[model samples]
Target chain A: MSEPIDRKTVESVARLARIDLPEDQIDDTASKLGDVLTYIGQLEQVELPDDVEPFFGAIESVNAIRPDQLTDSVDREQILSNAPDADGEFYQVPPVL
Target chain B: MDLSTLSAAELVKRLSSGELTAESCTESFLERIKDRDSSLNSFVSTAESAISAAQAIDERRSTGQAVGALAGLPVAVKDGICTAGIATTAGSRMLEKFVPAFDATMVKQLLSADAVVIGKTNMDEFAMGSSTENSFFGVTKNPWSDQHVPGGSSGGSAACVAADLAPVSIGSDTGGSIRQPAAFCGITGLKPTYGRVSRFGLIAFASSLDQIGPMARSAEDCGLVMNVISGHDSNDSTSAKNDVPDFTQTLNDSLKGLRIGICKEHFGEGLDSEIESAVNESVKVLESLGAETVEISLPHTPYAVATYYVIAPCEASSNLARFDGVRYTHRAATAKDLTEMYCQSRAEGFGEEVKKRIMLGTYALSSGYYDAYYLKASKVRRMIKHDYDSAFEKVDLILGPTTPTTAFKIGEHTQNALAMYLADIYTVSANLAGVPAISIPCGLTSAGMPVGLQLQARSFDEASLLRVAHQFQLQTDWHTRRPNA
Candidate 1:
């Protein structure tokens, strides 16, 4: 259905999603993802009223904002305890040149 | 009496009365988990703190310190909900070893209500799949049939209740994660109105569609759990500011003159015959109890699955981007650069289904495809909500089969992800409509597998929804039957 999402497309989408797909697995991934997209493609048949606005979430309420004043936060050391590699004050990551 | 077999409400009552000590109560359940869960695989990790916590609760009760609502009943939490000092994986390898620093708002509420958090239940990896097969942990088997799947994402939660591993559980539903599993496992599961419960520490799936709710053996237990969890929170902007009634207060309300809608489209193709008869019989039972059944239509029902796949994964892609190995969870051992680190860590950390969904979402939200996919699905999502809005005017609640069939054998749909997604046809619309829906066992099929009857009501109408389901349970013995462990 809809050409099984060719390997090239899988490669492109994987890049966008930031998941590195090994070359050997690309074809299988494309086909499986393609099957789901093809089913989702059934949406093409539903004719909607031209005036209907796209609904995002369940709530229609305006954003809830709070005072900008600084408040108590989780302990920095405790929060950093979950970090993969944390230094004294910050998380360690691959250095960007 | 096996303490594990009692409802969460009964356990709370007995514990508060000092008839059952919290230590003995927690230990009995911990024993159940220890003896039974090895076969069910319902728990990813059981808490070692449970006994000591129960001991503290016993001391508090003995000292005349006021006990909270739950009274120290052990409640299983879906792995996605953060539990401070406990490993919360969401069944993904990405967070396999990551322990949270703080409990989720609901977990905090459970603690405040005097419930003991016994364990984190297994789920589909990142709550992506229909079966629990996608968990980084091993697959959770249906207690009724070992070869079959416990319907997923919330499968382990359902299994824990079905197997009496825990009297009640917390589960998050994005699509049909909670309802479908509960249906397959023959337990009661409620997906409260989208904002009825706070989502402060739920590991996000599809933010809009995801709502945390309860799973148990009966609607009364679900209502009891809902009482402890539902309410607006300052931390969750989307949580409704509406007044939350005591969820359990209305459980015994009469169903006299209640209006139940029966949608013809729901009983259409792809449904199994046994499920059809079970639900049809349930409607008759409801009518016998003075409820009225009206024929209604949810015209947009056909488009729900398609719309959900697009919206859920799109939200998921954005939500899961936080897992890119820099902070919490899995990081790649080797990466040449930051981009490679992000890509490779995600590639290695996530399971196939999670990655596939992320890719599908990225493609849908990609430059040219956004209007055609995400925007169109959103508009159809409006129509799905509108369908519910129109139906609610005709009837107080909508009833249908929770899933097309009973528990399917594990690995049956693993290779066919789309087919697995289609199994959620009847349950996803409730999420799309942002209404409250519940699944309760109606009867067993000819094959001896359980069938779930689903009911949906207008948003924030969980009280009425629970009341109606509880009324049905009062007249039905299906809710009382459990798999022989």
Candidate 2:
């Protein structure tokens, strides 16, 4: 909980979430998040056994998949129909690096 | 006859027996949506196309053709679900105009079973907030008290069902999104085991904890809907391949010898007195049904809220990265470069709460902090799951208050994010453990708001969960009580 959440850190998180935040709001959010972190810090007092394993995913299996089955799906036009901007066969977007 | 007041089982019976035509039920609900939803703000999009769909079902009925199990029963889907040409916003402006090309696997299953989707309901933007206040559209008021919030990210779905706008609505539970609001509004809602239902079309929030389940007036209807929606799906790699049981068929079995565990941690200090009474009274009803209750310990419960806050947002930060403007959804109004465009689009599209979570999650999972915060939290989450595993060894099911308090006034906790986050204290543990849990109406506060009692069962055991919940519904009429909207 003592870990500091600064503006740059907040901005990086927004980027990870794919939401662009204004430079100004970053510091403000960092402070507010600091309060939330301080609140969550209360959990540190709860003691548990050393051997107990931490839970990361669901109790069940993970990423269990099957071979790609090509079944009839909607056409590209229908699939891309709602894209804000798209070319004839592709979703149009600004150039990516 | 108000279509909203009817239960799915009742409506399905009438539709099947020809006592009520599918077209009539569709028209009634559509009319109710037109008349009430403007003020309630429950539905995001209504199915004008449903009239034609209903007429087709009517035609089939007249022709003696086979109709699906839920045919003609009106269901409201959470906006997060892909509805094939219908907008699936996940209540964020980022995907405002994004309509899915294909139906979600659950949607396809419902259609095959003959469930007529009435509309898509509103939710917290990206399913972040406890109250629907975080929705990009606007806040959804509790149907019981218009000034108070309907608990959310599934708030709108819960509100619609509460006000009788839709017979049964579907909501996705990431934390307590579905069950909390169901409790707040005095309805029955279930969050099945993580892989029990396919998440193929659900807009990803925290992929690991997210599960789409049923919200309706009765446990039976929830079981009915669960039976239809639960099963394996190739599209969702995580969906379980096990055979789904007939939830309704096993619902009435006596809970005579089944053990119900009551956690002392849940009935702790901060819980509202009214909620405590409601849980106690519901337990009495269970006792009347001949089931014995045993006090159980979930010592790690205190750390559950903290663990969930770290884990859910950490995953959401990763899952939501797809919303970048370069690839999809919102684009900047004006930008000098691609970077500016990406940033501006995101800043403008997401709501404040969503941004807050992104920041929190990002910080926790950041390079320097991951092991200390995110990894540490994951370890606590494992302990929480272990707590449930240990408790289940002694009892068949666990019961407690769904939310410590009933729905608060709309703007009550908006300024205090942590207080609102704490509202999910009792509900998040189940999500962390990936078990089947349900919230059913047990009692109401003096202010007339609903109080929900939550019951949880081990992995893939929704059958027992529903049976106990259904028996509770049978012995008590709390679930049948409705808000006078």
Candidate 3:
């Protein structure tokens, strides 16, 4: 049986998603998730065929394919326009120290 | 005249034959956007460059240069896809300033095929929320109804297409982003088998689950765009090496003898009664078209949302780590240290929905809970896939409501995260199973909102799915209906 999702877990998820959620909303998310989980739990009761292979997120290739020939690309300014911070051609970041 | 209501294939022919000039078509759309975009808020950024490009294409065509498949056919892109010299905000404040110098692989493919790039459509920030309300820019209203949501994170693409602001648009789906919106907006959308299209320039959300696909007015148009962008790419190692098919070529194929599976699990409790009827009616239409309907059971369907919630956020958390203030996103006005800067930048850049997902994902992968949550979800995902494989053995395709309901009022599900996620209940399994799926308008809901029926097929079987959809489309005028302006 699947366990009930709780407020703590919801808060944890909120933090992971990087949204700042008020503590008040945590319980709501958990309870709602619990209901959804309950709905999904019904599937566990059903039997699956024996020959089925597990579904993976699409397929993966050993080596990424690319054209062998070199080609000139667009300038860096065009790529960096949306960057929050940039210095010349490269993205700018705080010093590691 | 509603220039936005024209189909891409039709527009392509008109432009090629000199019946319609690229400049005129571009101006018509620009005029439409000017007149209508304020109410729908579908576009984030319009491409002035595209107009010039269309003009240039016209010049080349006059000089005897061959016009490509999509020549002068305008298409919008979701905000998440990087466009050369265009803002690719991903609907988050984090990349609010970030722009890409190079085009994404899919964008390049469109350009090479002479597809006119129109503008960037809005979406849920980082494709996190199921409703466009999660966008930092504010919610995109459904064109069908001002009070309803367009669905997300590709809601902008769907809404814009539905409103006829653009002939077609490109969108990404990580758990039904494109399909759900297409369903909500009453248009056509395809989520090709994962890796069917290259992911080179798409910002990673759930890296494993994210895929770029076509959204358009009809199945044939989706196939046209799919043909140009579905090939494997070197930039994305996970892309399939399968031969790209001429999708439109098979659009008119007979649906005779096709086997479509109707999943009992999908229609169980939680589905809107109206949506169920719409889908059932569609299945009936397909049956009348000569395709056989078989009842199939994927008992594991229920577990998909649970499995998806765990997996998508976990992957999202990992992928989003690159956006630390020090790295790329918004930085605090004053941060005492690097760690604080990272936290604050993230806190400010991400919308509430995005943050919730990240936190859920991070906790799922955290030290003590990894096996219990992340690993368990992975296992469940595998089981879900297996169920699909088994079902496909008996049927050629699966039919269901792309969403459990029509587009809900914008604020209806925002207060309830679970309810919002449930909207994707009928659509997410395809992402987990890595199969191709399409959503086509079937009927209008009682509220006058468009209802979409989702059709899914086995991996690499897009031709079969499109053929059936096209056949159904030919018989019914659902796909041809445009929202009244």
Candidate 4:
């Protein structure tokens, strides 16, 4: 198996994912993550053809753009209705400054 | 006659003939949900608008106005699909109170077809787990056995149909999410070809793999729903441009001289002995119906689970990034800064399984690990797709068991994530290959739990998949068996 994911790496990943994991769960999280990585490490052993292309999505016609035109939009009140904190028209967020 | 016992197709004939009113049919389902859903926990929210809609259909029919295909049929939709003014939580706490301002494209189609929207069903949180145990609401119990899990993230959709709470329900499948649950609950589930059904309103799990499908009592019932839902939509760019065909037209067609491929890889290693026997028996029934079966090889099948784990998480990590505190519901109250608010809100909102996948996906797509994990897995995905493409050259359909075993008890695999992930081994390849597949109940295990026989056809070939499944249901009584619950 490849090197096990260390707690430091797990912590860094949580930071990158923007999830605030608690300190005590770090080691447990790292172990679980390592288990998954080890399971997926089997892919490294397969010899792939160098010419093969990496697939990002299914094969279908691309650039399916529609003609630009004005269309009906959802009501402004309905759109903001689900916001946790909305000022009737605008969503409220923590001040960046 | 009990309206709940009739299939969607049967209900359509009755409603059209004026033997039963849509209002009465809607009332029966609402009454059943009230009586039974307390034990099953299949529904997240029931719609009062469903009754009003059914009443409108009755009014139209009495006034001699033409109604749509599924006039008056009450159908449940999985919570992941947005409904205008209805709470679509996706079984997660993060969107506990979030209601969409507009209906999902498919929901709009369902409404236009004049079907009553009964309620939103439960599922795995963010469509993440193999069992419904991961839902923030609570685990959905299998209709066959309350102690066992209804396989997820479309568990509620499957369970509701099996329990006769709804004649048909809509589900979204990423990796076997629809089929596995259908197998566990003893019903029919279809995962249409990728982009066959528009995903405009579906909460993204793995955008490349996620496809909304139909779950119902029989293949014919599934086909009826498929007819209404499968079509092109300008809103979903990935939605196929292929013309929608009448899926039920070939239900009675002879399967004589059809070539069915039996992949050796699907039947070996870790598969339950009872399930193996049942699936083998299903092949015999198909052969007896005048179809020929041949042994085929999908050598890269072993890599599907691993490749899916890498690819799905990578997409999910990106898709879920929109759940930050700036938009929709759930914000951290104690955060003093912008970054802290984002972090703390997500940490509190998402469940354990969702957090684990997010982290795994973040690690895989990290700057240094990109080539080693995400890109490598993508190449392997191509090989998996090629395996299906080459096999289809020699056969019309590929057959296999839907899951390795029947439904296990709730909390069985919650502690071990890898074990839970393996439950999708037989179901993921079709998703990775972007093909149409269906799961129909074939037999019951020694414990009386149901086993699903899966049939996969070439991409955009749901017509063939539905035809074959319909024929099999006609020959066997398996799909007719109902749980004692």
Candidate 5:
């Protein structure tokens, strides 16, 4: 907590988020993110109660499984029409290899 | 004077009694939007079919056919909620061109109730920032003074109602998004309990914390909107199975028996003296109505903003992963492969705050720091929830200032990250605990801007919350004040 976060951490984390952080923004973005993290670091000061479950928002429901039935879905054409590159029934994407 | 200045209840009565045709009412609002939106920048886009839809409603009502409860009501909706044919941009370029194929559950409910969609109001991109300045469309100026912000992510929704562009509007709240904006704009907004309203079509910001609710000129108007919007949805599993109540039926509930709590943690150092007096004055008005106030302490409150920032972003990073340049959203044309496309699309699509949060989330959930950050934050979240749980045992509602100060000038805090996050200090605890809360204008600051008094209630207790808010509104005229726009 004593050390401010560095630019390398921002780049790696942005990569983890699948975002390309612009080179010019790295220094400023890292400094700001470091300040926020330092602010968030206050969480480290409090003692957490035992067995704190993973929060899934306000609703207490976890993995709310329902009957697996085929319900009406959005029309296929309507769904495809929104894709940036649609190939008839499927979304067309760049080559994997 | 124009019909745009009329209240929602008056508009509804006139529409139902045939004193005002639906088309004329819709046109009046559209005209207001045309006249003021250029200056306020509240709307992202207006519905082209609004006039014709209003005409249809008028025709149905005249022919003695059945019309819904919201017959002919013109309402503005935040852009984050999906509207079948309208663009559902969450103020992010990523979904800027994305037109939803279906109406969100709440929007569908509004349509069935005969409400007309006036337009999609502007918002912070993905409902992220505390000010609407983060929007891709452009900043929505505060209606009270063009120099200040109309608090955000739901900034546009609050401004629309405050400026009379619409009688009421729908807005989504993740952390103070709805209430803060409503406070900043001198209006009424409610953040219903987590499961109180269906989130089937609200664009996900933090799935666990996000909820859709109404913002209007009065709590009674918000209650009418809530009656249509709140209920269980099969499409959303986390939605409560409880039957929705008639919110309008509860407004007449007396304030005499209620015990509202005063959280001392909220009054200490960071609060502005002006907002403090305004909140103290609101307590007097409530007490005059026979309500009692008690002292309560939320010991864990100091850690709430820290907990929310950590927890919300972790959820956001995971939720926003769907924007991979493949289906339904913006895509970068220059990418040569799938991975490059994913990286490029999001980088270009999201604004600075969105990306910052996403990265922060990715880091917190990363292997080395997961236990130290996300896990610890989650546990602290429970501690915060426990504080509210214990407090609720002694009181029916908790009262505080919605914001530390009045609507600040735009760009004032945009450069300061921690300062921006600190603004939600008083409002985020309700979201962290999944409770219902509201913001109502109680007084004006010396600078002549509105000051909002916030009240929080236990989960699923919006009926009591709205009732108390309604009772308070009747005793004061703060909610009646409109911006010069």
Candidate 6:
């Protein structure tokens, strides 16, 4: 059996993820997260040989490079059309200050 | 004859003969969605432009112009795929109002093939859950039984095809999102080789495992769509540059001497008895068709769900971090500072499951715990792939249940996230190994829910996988069965 994740750890992780959790819901969320961690703890039982390499993706394919050339793919107006808050020329975001 | 009941292949034949116009075919599907979609909730939005596009196709045909392969067929796209000028929500509130100004490469290919775009179908939020219940839009009910869930994150795509809302649909699979729901909804869905289909416009969940494929009433129809969608794209770096074969060419090929491996691990405990018997009966059918079947052991199979939970969520955590209240995502209306706005926006925009996964991924990928969790899971993922590599050396393909059990009751797994994750046990390994796999309806349970038989093949060898599934579908009547609703 593994150690259950405490509320402090949950809070720390939520902070790292940039998500805010209410204090009242922290305990419940911690316990639920603990359950999932315990379930995943089974992976620790697999014996890995020293020579085994971790697999990140499927077979490696060589990158394709093309000659640099000027091209217009997407129109500037089309690109800005989906922005939630956009001025006539640029996206409008809150002031950095 | 009712146009809604016709298969994509049959519809294409009629359209080719000039007996039916594309406009009439698109209108029929749109009318069906209007009539039945309220109860099923399969479609998130219907496309008005689809009618105009179909009318153009009819005009082209009248002028004796050549039409593409999938002319006049109405196809539904999963909401996760971007469609130009259409709202492409990944079933999350974060993208609820976000519309892409450009079409996904697959959507462009579909239009080039002259297939009518029906609309966007609903799905799990950000392609996260096994049940469509996680969608911010609302849960999509199983067309077979309204009380049950349509398996997800591709649940809406599967349910739409089964209920005849659209003749065919496209969905992405990252750890069985497409195959599991297809099993539950009694339709055929394919998750091609990791890079067989381009991922240029698919919203990423796990980049290494995500693949977009076809979902339809038959494997033959999937092949028809595959011919149009499969090819290399310069936009997606991971997409394979392998030559695209005409998948429909082998649909009628004999399966004599095909070696099929029945993984002992897949049939073990927790599999429903009805599904087990149905799968066993399917093996017998394969044997009678002259294919050799052998019992093989994929010893590391049990660890697949555990490894997937770690790796997928970790990748998702990083992928979804882009939604910070900066450029185009949901922003908090009231915020004193940037950090507070980022925190509050993510907390409000993401659903419970998405947030839980983000938290879990954050913990796994965090410092001090990275080696013990993320690194360890990656090593185990290699072992899972090694097992499949060894099994494929002896057999041409692997066969098993698509899901351990059929579709469960809606809200059954909402509270228990681990239980929901376990539902993907039979399907995740294919994604982990970057192989091609498919789910086709094999049988129905005593309660009348559909069961799917899964088949997996070597990387980029989707031709063999589709051939076997097509032959089985030809001999069985399960694919022909429809819901009473």
For each candidate, what is the lDDT?
Answer: 0.92, 0.87, 0.83, 0.92, 0.91, 0.92
Q: Evaluate fnat for each of the predicted models and list the values in order.
A: 0.81, 0.56, 0.48, 0.73, 0.79, 0.65
Candidate 5: how large is its RMSD?
1.3
Residue pairs with backbone atoms closer than 3 Å in model 5 (clashes): none
B187-306 per-residue lDDT for model 5 (tens digits): 999999998899999999888789899999999999999999889888888799777899999899788878999999999888989999999999999999888999999999999999
State which candidate has the highest lDDT. 4
TM-score of 2: 0.96
lDDT of 5 at B289: 86
- CAPRI category for model 2: medium
Q: What is the lDDT of residue B12 in candidate 3?
A: 88
The predicted structure with the larger DockQ, 2 or 3, is 2
Candidate 1 lDDT for residue B91: 95
Please estimate how well model 2 matches the true structure, expressed as its whole-model Cα lDDT: 0.87
As a whole number from 0 to 100, the lDDT of residue A73 in candidate 5 is: 89
Report the lDDT tens digits of candidate 6 across residue range B288-397: 88899999988899999999999999999999998886655577788677788889889988999899999999999998889888899999999999999999999999
Which has the better TM-score: candidate 1, or candidate 3? 1
Q: Tens digit of lDDT per residue, candidate 2, span B385-438?
A: 889989999999999999999998989998888899999999999999999899
Model 3 lDDT tens row, B130-249: 789988777899988898899998999999888888998999999999999998888999999988999998999998899999999899999889989998787788888899889888
Point out where model 5 deviates above 4 Å. A50-54
Looking at candidate 2, what is the lDDT of residue B458? Answer: 90
Task: Quote the lDDT for B361 in model 4.
Answer: 94
For candidate 5, the iRMS in Å is 1.6
What value does the lDDT take at residue A32 in candidate 6?
Answer: 86
- What TM-score does the predicted chain A of each candidate obtain versus native chain A? 0.90, 0.72, 0.65, 0.91, 0.80, 0.78
Candidate 6's fnat? 0.65
